[model samples]
Target: ALYYYADNPQRPYDPEKAKQMLSAAGVSNLTLKYLIRAGDEVDEQTAVLVQQQLAQAGITANLQKVDPSQEWDMTIAGDYDISVNYWTNDILDPDQKTTFVLGHDSNNNYMTNYKNDAVKDLVAKARLELDPKKREQMYIDLQKMAKDDVNWIDLYYSPYINVARKNIDNFHQNPLGRFFLEDTVKN
Candidate 1:
């Protein structure tokens, strides 16, 4: 349970509520541009699923396939209305993900451009916190705040997998999906 918090916010599926909210806001016939990276079957499938879900909520998402080569530049520059993407934390640290992706001051804010003074303050404190428990609590608080802000929506996390020969001894993949082969020996 690296980053599991018992009180984490839960997003229950409520398409009716979404429709009601849109109606209350006087929004009708709403359509959004959804960016999907081209040449990825998984991404295309995900986009289709998301499109169907949004249609259920009375919102139309116009899918646009962007070339993988230019998707990063376009997404980072806030050029799209909505983009489907994923982030992998190779470092396996909450700070590594939060600082760059969510922090307001970070250059790699992932096109959200979300600015929150409280988030910035917490990030600074967590960075300097020596106690692991306190630091974890700080991150938990940040996560709660992030959920409330709703700047980014996390769909799902996919675990990294590796295939190797049975004779490979001590070949273990770390939590971050990194392989340290130096200590591994073949049988």
Candidate 2:
């Protein structure tokens, strides 16, 4: 879970501003149907949270509880305006990230139905840059392309909370945001 920040730091959430933008774009009466998996605990919680927030923004949000597989199919088909999901993103390279975000991949369920050329081009350039600094800049460009297109509206970055038995020793969490049981032993 991560919040998608725009390229410009000054741009903050302004509902009125959003209304104007949508209005200028000739978009109105936009009822966003939000699809979320039924049985998953985290998904249920996230769906409720998102529903509340979207309601406050005056976007009519309807929540649909569906089976997880069907949920993905629906999202992939661009059937809904919004979807609540949990992702385990493997942060590799910029290209790897785009595989979901830019193209037709499982990760990108934005339903924008846009094939952005700039996003794809920038990601390819980033991948070719062996220099870390150059690569970083390319990634920055790629991100802005994503933001400008509004490919995904990220909500929050989440950390895992773990509860272990008292007897477990050396149960340290890893930087990858998960607990490791490698050195752990029962007392």
lDDT of 2 by residue, 73-163 (tens): 8987878878865445565344665656675444442445657876767666666778877777676776777777767666676876788
- Tens-place lDDT digits, model 1, residues 30-107: 999888899899999999998999999999999989898788788777777788788877676677777886787646
- Alpha-carbon shift of residue 53 in model 2 (angstroms): 3.7
Relative to the true structure, candidate 1 reaches a TM of: 0.90
TM-scores of the models, in the order given: 0.90, 0.78
Clashes of each: 0, 3
Task: Provide the RMSD of all predictions against the true structure, rounded to 1 decimal.
Answer: 1.9, 3.6
* Candidate 2 TM-score, C-alpha based: 0.78
Candidate 1 regions off by >4 Å?
Answer: 1-3, 185-187
lDDT of candidates 1 onward, in order? 0.82, 0.69
